[model samples]
Target: MGLLDGRTAIITGAASGNGAAIARLLAAEGASVALLDIDGGGAANQAAAISDDTGAPVFGARCDVTHAADVEAAVFQTLETFGRIDVLVNNAGILLDTPLPGLDMTAWERTLAVNLTGPLRFIDTVAPAMIAQGEGGAIINITSIGGSLGFASYAAYCASKAGLMGVTRAAALALAPHRIRVNAVAPGIIHTEMTRGLYADPAALAEITAKIPLGYVGEAVEVAKTVLYLACDLSSYVTGTELTVDAGYVAQ
Candidate 1:
């Protein structure tokens, strides 16, 4: 049997990249996955692909994590379809590389809304149901190494992720009694659609790869595997922790 047999998961921003990889991996491990993305069509397509590949129950919907109503509706839809939610992966985020002087307040606000508040909404909407089920659950937040490390021109992004790390810890403490474990997976320089710009420039890619003690860029599946570990019973005793999947980038 798979590690996540009989479990159900909701993964945000799952249309592509790390989110998609997470969804696919969870489904392979026997979890019913609900893919939520701003791009509903893309999410649906991905869900269909994973379901076809793994023969697992997977579906997709349009969900804007910044909006409470959207998040609530999507959670409801997942519950109705999968019957119960055992895992929640808050993986939706945007990167805004802006320095201090030209920093856009609007961009900063949007980043917090999507990166920080978004996870709050999902946790708020799902926590109660998870409690009612009485089996305990796992909530995995997709934070970033940027959350703990300084990055030039990434003021808002760094701040938002750091805030999410705080949220993960607080929620973990608050929900431990109910047996719900909250944790975060902070990724380093992973080459995804979100970081396509850096990969597009050979110099930038080389510069980033050089910083990693692993001596290479990380992949979406590598991060997804970490999410899998947290989502499964393997990390049952783990909570309120931030697991960094940065190829030892921040160790230096």
Candidate 2:
């Protein structure tokens, strides 16, 4: 038996990269996964592929986490199909590489809307059902090491993630009474399509690799495994914590 057997999970930004990886892992462990993304076609294709490969119930929907209507529709559709949501992975995020001086209000607002407020809306919508179900649930927020560390050009992205950490803590406490757990996963230097441009530069890649104590770049699956732990009973006693998957980058 798998850890997440019989669970239903909602993963945002699951069309590709870490979100896709997490969805696949969760489904493999017997969770029915709903992949939501702004790229509707990509999400649908991914769901079809996973369902075909694993013979598991996987669904996909077009969702812009920044929009309340989209989130509501997606959640409604997911509940209609899967019955209940047992796990919610808020993995949808954007990186705006604007320095403080060059930052525009629009970009900052958009980043927060997608990265911070988006997760809140989802929790607000789904938490009631999770509470009503009385089986409890897990919520994993995909944060970044940048949230804890100061980066020169990642002001907005870092701020949003840091704010998400705060949300995770507050939500954890608020939901604890109902047995719902909230946590954050902080990743560092994972090689995904979103970071393809940086890894394409050999010098930049080498510089990043050197900083990692593991002497190698991380993979999407590595982060997925961490999410799996938090999604399942393996982390039953863990909540309101930030698990860093950064190869000890934050240690130094």
Candidate 3:
């Protein structure tokens, strides 16, 4: 029996990287999953692959987290297919590295829209449904170390993630009575397409990896495992907390 057997999950930005890893893990653990991504085709293909690999009921849909209509449609579609939403992984986010000296407001706004407001849209659309389900649920937000440790050129990204931390805590308090748990997972220097650029430059990769106490880059599966823990009964008592999966980067 898998930890998430009979449960259902909705993972945003699940076409690739960490989001895809999380979806695959949860589905393998027996949860019906909806992989929602801006790249609809990619999401569908990944979902089909996971279904084949895990024999889990999984589907994919196009969802733009920044838009309310898109968020509503995706939630409706997931409920229509899976019957209930037991877990929500708000993994849809974008990072724009821009310094404050001459930062473009456009970049800042876009970053917040996708990274911060996007999660809000999902919570607003899904929380009420979870409450109505009466069985309680879990909401996990994907954050970054940039939220805590300021990055030189990541003002917008950092600010957005920090705001998400606030959202996770506030949402937890608001939904505690409903048995719904809200939490945030902060990943550090994970190997993903999002960080592929850094990998291309050996010097940059080494410099970045050197800062991590683990002495290496993290993988998507590791982050997925953390999300799985929070999604299942193993973390039943955990809520409104930020679990840092940064290879001890914050400790330094």
lDDT by residue (tens digit), candidate 2, 1-252:
888889999999999999999999999999999999999999999999999988889998899998999999998998999899999999999998768786788888999999999999999999998999999999999999989999998899999999999999999999999999999999998989878987779999988889999888899999999999999999999999999999999999
10 residues in a row with least lDDT, candidate 2: 96-105
lDDT of 3 by residue, 72-148 (tens): 99999998998999999999989887886998899999999999999988998999899999999999999999899
- Local error of candidate 2 at 150, Å? 0.8
Residues 136-163, model 1: lDDT tens digits: 9999999999999888999999999999
TM-score of 3: 0.99
Error of 2 at 44 (Å): 0.7
How far does residue 104 in candidate 1 sit from its true spot (Å)?
Answer: 0.5
- Error at 91, model 2, angstroms: 0.3
Clashing pairs in 2: none
Residue 149, candidate 1: alpha-carbon lDDT: 88
lDDT, model 1: 0.96
* Model 1 CA lDDT for position 130: 100
Clashing pairs in 1: none
